[model samples]
Target: MKYNNPVIKGFHPDPSVCKVGEDFYLVTSSFEYFPGIPIFHSRDLVNWEQIGHVLTRESQLPLKRVHSYTTSQGIYAPTIRHHDGRFYVIAMNVSNHKTFYVWSDQPNGPWSEPIIVEGLAGFDPSLFFDKDGKVYLTAGAFPGFGPEGIIQAELDIESGQLITESKFIWKGTGGSSPEGPHLYKINDWYYLLVAEGGTEYGHMVTVARSKNPYGPFESNPHNPILSNRSTKLPIQATGHADIVQACDGSWWSVFLGFRPVKSTKVHHLGRETNLAPVEWSEDNWPIIGNNGRAEIQHNGKSLPLGEPIPWQGKEEFDDESLTSVWNFYRNPQKGSWSLTIKQGSLTLYGQSSTLNDYESPAFVGRRQQHFNCEISTLMEFSPKEEGEEAGLTVFMNENHHYEVAKTMKQGKSIILFRRCVGSLWKVENETEYDESIVVFTIKATETDFTFSYTKTNGELEVIGSGETSLLSTQVAGGFTGLYFGLYATGNGKVSTSPAHFEYFHYLPGDE
Candidate 1:
């Protein structure tokens, strides 16, 4: 079967995979998005479906008011593994400076409350289960580890306690910021894989091996086993990979990479998950891809291809709870939003923080998976205060975003288009609309994004257009992709009214 490079698309990065019998399970970093650590399941390595999230309750993962100077500071990297009869996921929250693990009997699950692994320092942690049933933990160096290097220690899985002192391991093959370590015991040797080059253009995957679980390891002669940094293959910044063996004894790797816009080094979709084939030489070293580079397409005999499900189009909030596709910025405050209060609508109570603030506003969104797509929502809001506003938003972060909202101007309801890049704020366009309900739409292309609105009996009137490059990671400086959703804010003052969204419609363009 021939499979495309990005088997999983849009902002799902730092993929960690583990096989349990014939089924393969994977997890990725969710950054500041609520219900963190998206877990996926696949029969074939090529096709995937989101099973659920590891963190479901605020008590399990508290992200309320989680502020970050950089948009990439929330969840760093996560490693998923299956040992004995249970599945485990270990990760770190960079903004909170904490490390923890969660476990469940099933892949799609009501996971256990976070077992905070105290005294474990640094980010990007992985768990290794030895053949003797002894478990080990490996992570990047921090102030607690003394000096900069990878560290290892024996851990008691049940108690989340370290049974032994942490020891230093491989420092990496002369790359900046060595992180995302995974330990694998294959054949007679124990292999340690880590990502380096800082998760940017120079990102790469390097490996080393040792006879013992913890010891002086030897780096592979072909250091960077996989990378596209030296090529202009549309897929750039490829690294942070995880390896898994199929039931057919074939080795495959799933890693994070991004496709930049043509003729420009800007990627607004963030780092996505890509699939590649792996081969082992007679010398036992693993080889990645055709020429040590990831390709846009891969050919091999894979598990039977499953029917693709259509996840795009209209979203009607008629259910008792929000769908799995919806995510909030960080953790949402208790009772800030609701579905049961309004029949067939999502009601978002107005919050004091705006989208420009580093605090969580009343917002819920889904990722912009394609470069060219159209998103629109029917919103009904009557702001009782001057600062309160509600509408549609194409959000990248607190520092970078665009909003087309319904606000009160001179005691009259009007539509407003606001553009925010860094510290600059400008209301580029506005038009008076007296209706309580209106449809706001944003048409986004590879190069630009246009905002427009429509009344009950009116045509789509163009509000304004802005450069899409301004929201790219190159300009906004974040590790997350674009998100389009509904938002309600009162600037800094609280409001009594709530914003009600009837439905959200999305259409991905062929281009």
Candidate 2:
């Protein structure tokens, strides 16, 4: 069954779908986004409910190296499967190539602690269970260090242990860097579907088949079964797909692509999810998309009626801990941030002096949905000493971001739009808004971003507004969301005071 609109959207990439009876569960990669690998549940492949996240506790994965100024490493794509009544997920912490697995009895799970698989370095790890109940793991093979192709290894079904040495299966049929393999058994042939083109403009989907799981395979004649190479549209990149048969026996494919916003060609949202249908030809070869190219239109069906989970937006800083919607760029500090409804706002303690610092400064932000949007926050800020500032920001990386901050100059308060230069907060633009309270708003229209600040005296000033075509993962180079957040930082040896943020709202499609 084809969906008029896909069930999954946003930065949800590398979708792995599993069906247990009539219910279906899907998981996607969360690189730097905390609460990694958001798991979604659906009955009709159209409507999806975020059942839970696979990694909630920090102990399951560490972020010391991942959250650093020198490097950006986070968990990459993951594959989820259900075997014998137990649910399993195989994932790779891309910063380090070690693979790990987690298990749960229920799809909406109180999942088990991660059991690190015996392996070195690799990405895009997936698990395959054959008809004989034998398990195998498939991953992207890296060369210069080892092999240059897709590699597979036997896994113990009961212990989730590696049983056989990793072996190379196929080098790809003249395609560069073949990876992202999803193993499937159709009829009597074992099919391996892979994504090639190096996650860039040349990205495509191809397949190979073998009679035995451990032998040489024949490449599909209709290789690159789906791609956007023919389109002149802004959406250039596409690939990294997984397929599954609906309970009604219809086939569907989920993959990743990007929709560029004018000058903001650097997509802060990373790669987005795309959907298409798969049809088998007379010779048993698979053809994807109705016209040999992915449809530009949304193809997911409407979800069945249920008491839907509320659409996520507008976070109240009432609870003592951070909400699920909030995640730190690197590692979070113990008392850097908190939520206190009784205090009437969210309090963020100052940490790093600038955005590029490795210490996870008091930052709480959400995903940018890759379109027009308005994000606003109200705050009462108190600087610890001189040079201290607190404000709202749109962050892509430490070096690439813009913020409106209230800072103490001499004995007076001033507002500024600042960008980061290592430890220094360079004042790109500023205005003399000597007020204790302020309302800051950022309006993003497609690729352009504008900043507005209003003082308590009703004086509204435009601090710094310009085209932000610099927030793309291709440009900024991280697997994190383009963040709109509330943050604070102290200068020297100083006593810190909490910056109270009243509300943070993202009005998507704002005119």
Candidate 3:
């Protein structure tokens, strides 16, 4: 069987995986997006289903005023591991400077409240369970301006405390930004894997091993066991990997990589999860892919293919609660939005006036999974004030976004096309429409985004178009992907009324 790369697509970066019985569970970084660390399940390594989020409640993962800094300064990398009949997820909150762990009996369920790991420094924390009932924690430590190296410490899982002094381990294969470290005990040696050369075109995965868990480690002679840097492959920046052995005794790896359109360098969908086969050499060293490069198609003896679970398309907003696909900008304020307040509609009370501010507005969105897709929503908003606006937005970050909103101007309802890149704001297009209800739409292709709307005349009219490259990480300079969803704001003043969205439909190219 041949499986495609990027088993999970769109902005889900820093993938970590662990297997239990016949089930394989995975997690990825969410960075400033509320309900962080999306949890996924798969019987075969190819097909994945998002079961739930690891950080669901504000208490478990707080994002208070996170947008005040930058969109990339929230949750960094999360590592999920299953041990002793319990599942554990450990992650770092860069904005809040906290390292915490949450556990549950099952992957999708009532996860335990966060237990802050005191005295642990650095980012990209991972857990390694030894065979003798001992657990260890490792991460990248930056004590100075030099190479950020890997660190190790014994962790008392029951109390979430360090039982020993932290030790600095290998600094990787001398690549820049050596981070995302994971430890594995194979045979009689402990192998440490780390992603180096940053998370861009130079990204690579390197490994080291030692007989003792904390000792003089040796770097792999054939270093950078996995990478696609400087190659013409469509998938680039391949690193930040986690390995797991299947129930059938086969080794596989899931890592983060981005797919730029052929002959182009811009990729707006961000880092996604890609899987590749791991072949162990005679010396017991793991070789990833052929010649250390991942491929779009992998052929091997894999778990049987199964039907894919449906996700993110045509939401009617009639459910009692927001579905797992919808995520807020930051930690949403209590009662800021509700579905039951207006039956069959999602009512979003406007908070902030603009999207560029460091405030969490009434916004609910899902990741833009594909470059070519159509997203639209029917919004009914009657702004009594001048700055109140509500409609659809393609958001990259607080400083970068495009919105097609209905705002009040000169005591009349007007549809406006606003684009904000950095500190610049351009109202590229606007038209006066007397209709109170409108359907806002955005047709996005690989390189462009077309904005349109339907008013009282019941005809779709094009408003404005923008280059999709403006939303790419290369242009926007963020670690997140694009989010297309509903947004309402008062520009700073409180909105007299809320914006109600009847439905949100996202049709991918294949669909």
State TM-scores per candidate: 0.97, 0.91, 0.97
For candidate 3, the per-residue lDDT at 383 reads: 83
Q: What lDDT would each prediction earn against the true structure?
A: 0.87, 0.74, 0.87
lDDT (tens digit, per residue) of candidate 1 on 1-511: 7878688878899999999999999999998898788888898888788877888887777764445466666677899999889999999977777898989998888899988888876679999999998999999888455766689999999999999988888888989888889999999999999898988899999999999889699999998999999789878898999999999899999999999988898889889999888988789998777657998987866656676655647889999977777899977866679997889999998788888877778899998888899998999888777877899988899889999999877788789999999999999988888888899999989989999999888788999888888999999987898999798987787668888999999999864
**What 10-residue stretch in candidate 1 is worst by lDDT?**
63-72
| Per-residue lDDT over 1-511 for candidate 2, one digit per residue giving the tens place of the 0 to 100 score | 3443234545777788888888878898877656677898877665677777888777766665643543456677789998888999888876555688899998777788888887633568888889898888888787674767788889885676779888888877777888788898888999898898877678888989999886688998878887887566555567888887777677877788776665444555657676677789888878777645776664543324344456667766665666555666655677777675236588777875456665557677776764688888889886647777888888877766778888877866688887653344567886666567899999887667889888788877888875556666675665555777788877543336678898888777831
Model 3: per-residue lDDT, tens digit, 34-83?
88889999999888988889999988877765335456867889999999
- Pairwise lDDT winner, candidates 1 and 3: 3
Worst ten in a row by lDDT for model 2: 298-307
- Once superposed on the true structure, which residue ranges of model 3 sit more than 4 Å away at CA? 66-69, 143-147
Query: Best to worst by lDDT, what's the order?
Result: 3, 1, 2
The 10-residue segment of model 3 with minimum total lDDT is 64-73
Where in model 2 is the C-alpha error above 4 Å? 1-7, 66-71, 262-266, 298-310, 319-323, 341-344, 420-426, 491-495
Root-mean-square deviation of candidate 3: 1.5
The number of clashing residue pairs in model 3 is 4
